[model samples]
Target chain A: MTAAVETAQTTTIHGDRVSLLRVLGPAHVWALGVGIVLVGEFTGWNFAADKGGALAALIVCWIVGLLYTSVAMIDSEVTSTVAAAGGQYAQAKHIVGPLMAFNVALFLVFAYTMLEVSDAILLGDTIVAKAGVEGLTHNSFIAATIVVLAWLNYRGVLMTLNVNFVITAIAYVSIVVLFFSVSPWTQGAVLKLNELVTPGNALPYGWIGVIAAFQFGIWYYLGIEGTTQAAEEVRSPARSLPYGTMAGMITLLIAAAMTWYVCASLMPWEYLGITYYPLWDAGKLTGSPLLENLLFIATLLAALASANGCINDAARAWFSLGRDRYLPSWFSAVHPRYRTPYRSILFLLPIALAFAFIADLNQAITFSILSGVLQYTFMSINIMMFRKKWPLGSIRRGYTHPFHPLPAIVLFCLCVVTFFAIFLGFGSQLIAMVAFYFLISLWFHFYRYRFVRRGDQFTMPWPKPQGY
Target chain B: MWMALSYACWGISIVLALWMLYDWFKVDTTYSEDMLTSSREGELEAVSEKHRI
Candidate 1:
């Protein structure tokens, strides 16, 4: 109280402050993170099985689970203190320099936007498959999804995430329903245990196979860290951010395990790896129209929930960047009526629509995953720098992750292995993305930095760094 | 039949997008930059009892 009051007296009142609505609780944060990721269980994760085998995919699932647990801890610590909309991007700015923040903001934008695009495409495809109609263009469904979800986001954060919670809850229930329908408890029931030990099924591609599976392993929990993006909007960031994030991580780990078990036992690795909707396929294997219908509806809801979450996160990152004058200051404006980042939300709609229209689902997902991997890699460094600059007791943290540097080191090493896995599969695309970011960094340094408010960028009122 | 559904979806999307664009322009024309960019975070922070270092 004394320090804050003193700082307030010294600091200038820089006009009125335009901010996001801080109405969210831990539940909204959980919805935001889990909603963006639950869709992955339906579609993209099976690609890991395709790369390696069912056993390899399961191993990668747990490995990536460990990777994301570290992420949840590190992010919860940093975001609880930072309390900003851009999540890791905001953390980078306060802890590292502005250049790093700019790149991190881009990573958030692209990662979520690409994921949004993939979700929209899957939504459209699910509808198409359900209808089984000839000459049904997916463009309309994709466009409608982007438009509708962007509208939800532009309206308000509370409504957007509240809707996400409902749909995401239903989608999760669908997974549980599928798990129960198989009767895994009964001896010699629906599950074929041979799927695990069959020749070439356990480790189809050997060591390289497990490494390659790492690329798709992320699908099990891609956007759980996104819970922090709601930091600026949450009612109690310190408590809510960590609680929501850790809960979401736990939920995802359980969901991933159950999804893997049910799907792997129901189908052979050869078929499960290549299938688009492993859960839905498993539903079909039950020979029950009711289960199949339920799974299909569940997939649709998950896609919608994920797309909605992606739009919300990407727009917040863009809005934070705009607020800092990294881009046009005009984009920072909040809707007076709704208090939402309306302009930023509108700005990203076309970008997501463009990708949804042109890019294949696998390509869009690969790009999203790579973008996320890059962000996590940055996070490992960001947290270490944060501690060195302002060790413990220098500032108040909402929650402190245990085992300090261990999580950071583990996150870094896992990120390196994941990158190697991606390189084995997407070497050319990885190179292209690197080149693209390099070009953009040059542009930001030479051109955009002039527009940024350097002195005003540091919004937190904590004391200066040790050396500074 | 599905084509009709798709076309209807496209039509709804276009209409919704146009409305948003109109609202965007309306909001821009209606409000000043100062008012639009004004935030409540600083005010709340000042009055709050939580003592952040």
Candidate 2:
């Protein structure tokens, strides 16, 4: 443990007192991950790789799932140690100074916000398309969704969580039905899967799809940690945060891989790129009227379920900012009636409404991915820092992290690689985001040191930076 | 073990979702302050001020 860096005595705002039942068990956390990523079909993830004849990409997806064991196992210990409300922001502030931690939170705010905004756009597009408008030709679809969902969230978290519990349930039901339907038909598919992994069918050796699949897998698994971010609302953070992250990842990895294999093996590779919503297409092909409606309703439910959870999550960054005095104090105030961050929730609606009205879904995904990658990278580093500072004896544990430096180094490198990979994956928007953040951060601290003086007075050995 | 159980639970959840069409027939507007024990401006402000770094 670092001699000087003792853990801070901080009990941050974890909204309202609730029953132990309110805290999601790991299963719900995992379900939340599956809900976010396993949309209708992840045609978006591997269509090109599948067509480039990357049969091996499927196995590579499994390989990446294996790596989640190492990644999530470590997260279990770290989250247990610091199960605070701000997720990575709390962890990062504890490890690095607030300045660097602030950067992480700032980027993370964009990551989750963009993700919610994009999902809202997708929701809008789906509803609008049903009405018979040529999609890309008009700006109507994404716009309508943002307006509706934004209003839904502005109303409250109970509304958000209650609806979330319902929709996420239905969405998951459809996914299971899809796998089972494929199972009845493709009885021998998984056993005879060697043919699918042959050289000709797989992506070329060392193909980028392997990495892209990993990126998608990791990003798709991004929000499990988010379950901890809402730790305050839960009855117990110490128990739920640790178990939720571990359990959730394990569930998502198995569920996603199994569902992917069943669908991918049964459906022709040629059909993937043709449909944005592949499960429904798969259902139509199955000729199961019951199944198709179930899958359609299931996917719609997922998008709906996820929208509420994600929107509630997005407001947290603003709420944290408000709590920390980065924004108005009102932003941090919890609703007296709702016990949720009303100002921050209200803060989120206008921005989401604006993006929903103005931007397309893919653009929102690109921004979401870029910002999210930064938070993930920071989180991996935060674990490493905690290892240096905390006495291992102080943390009560079932699973202990292997000796430091090695795991931390490996995690840090993977995080760095993923960060760069995301930048490349979303090309120019990433560059634009970097520029945008730098400008905003610069402007934020510009007039500082001259008049305003703020920072961690207790921790400083020397005088603090101008205005923190 | 965790993975196997996760799969089983997911399958079970599918059955649960189908019930949504029947169960969620009329929407219920959820209140935001599901956990607010009572209006505690004093406690809320104390908690709020404590948060300022």
Candidate 3:
């Protein structure tokens, strides 16, 4: 039962080495990324409409889209080389130092965990609202959703994400179907384009409001970068990571456009901004019970799909922390039979459930958005260090991002703008999140640094970093 | 009826959670630390050694 320290030479162990199953391909990767994000199109993104107007929300969507495009390109390049479970945290360890890597891991864990919480809560509330049964609360349904998804993740990633693919695809098609069903293309279509141009509907709160709207614009593509979390599990990190991530990004952009058009065209900006279920409301406007029922089912499916992917990702990031001894090594163990991170998956379940039970939806979404934006800020720095330390031709890269510094620069600038936008709305929460991470950084520096094997942290067999 | 269904949902979830926790501790005891913390990244490298990409 002695723990073997990793070394330059082999330290023989008594039992067979266990690893996560490398069965996932590009489709699972697409499902993993999109499944976590498609739910936003169904419900969350319209809050942007509330802040500014429908036009401002649409503007912010394209701007934030640019930010995530940079994220995808930079992530695809680094993950192709690193190919580990923790995604950006793994990249941070190799590119930056251990302290930054620790924080990035926390960011990934909290961001996904909080998103999972909100998704679960949304599922509970949605069911309760629709069921029309007095005395029924969301507590049981919330518990059931988190437990069932965690169980699915515990069984294996392949089936979990395969199910995500089907459900996510269906949720996405629900939007497209609503779009075609409304027939905005025809002259006598049902869409009210006049509502879009109404006084104050274009920019109700002015330029500052447009800036504030950028925060909610993130909902459109919040967890798309999570595709990188599957790096270790994917069969071909080189081909699959970029293909799945970029394809998922394209799907999101198209979905976001259609969602905004359909929702904004059907309702006034004031109401669209405040509505709980924008897509479902848009379906109701068509006066079709069939589309309403279809959207209702789609909303539930989207939430389930999102919560399922979050469990997959949050567990992986936490598992990576355990594997690296950043947290307790006990959390690192992979199930021999299922080849999944059973301990990490179990560890996050209660934490998510507790947060789902108490956390306000807006607060949960805000924290998730802040954590995600912070990770993108790290990506800018990580990519710059990656190119400088390794340079080109230093090692084989599976996918190389075009226009290197440009993407990094754009990603950083957009992250700053998004942070400012978030500050305008949730200034206290932004400051509070920073203070929390800062305290954790201090704890890691003083208490946790001793446990980490610094040499073992850099796992890749590349030449020595240049000018290091 | 709604109340009964709610309780049933909660009961099923709690049982599932308990089973996972039980399995978690069992796996910890059954496996060695070396086996659990083994470098899967190294194994991945070995598998793709012929083609580094």
**Candidate 1 vs candidate 3, DockQ winner:** 3
For model 1, what is the C-alpha lDDT against the true structure? 0.88
**lDDT of each residue in A116-214, candidate 2, tens digit only:** 776665554554444453423223334334434544555444455555656666776666767776664544633234444455655653556555544
DockQ of each: 0.43, 0.05, 0.49
Query: Considering only N, C-alpha and C atoms within 3 Å, which residue pairs clash in candidate 3?
Result: none
Flag clash pairs in model 1.
A17-B38, A17-B39, A18-B38, A18-B39
Candidate 1: regions farther than 4 A off: A1-17, A195-199, B40-53
lDDT tens readout by residue for model 1, A297-374 = 899999999999999999989988888889987778888667788989999999999899889998999899999999
lDDT of 2 by residue, B1-53 (tens): 33343344345434443333232221112222333221221222223222222
**Runs in model 2 with CA error above 4 Å?**
A1-43, A47-56, A66-71, A129-159, A184-198, A204-206, A212-219, A395-410, A444-468, B1-53
Candidate 2 docks with a DockQ of 0.05
lDDT of 2 at A154: 52
Which of 1 and 2 is the better model by lDDT? Answer: 1
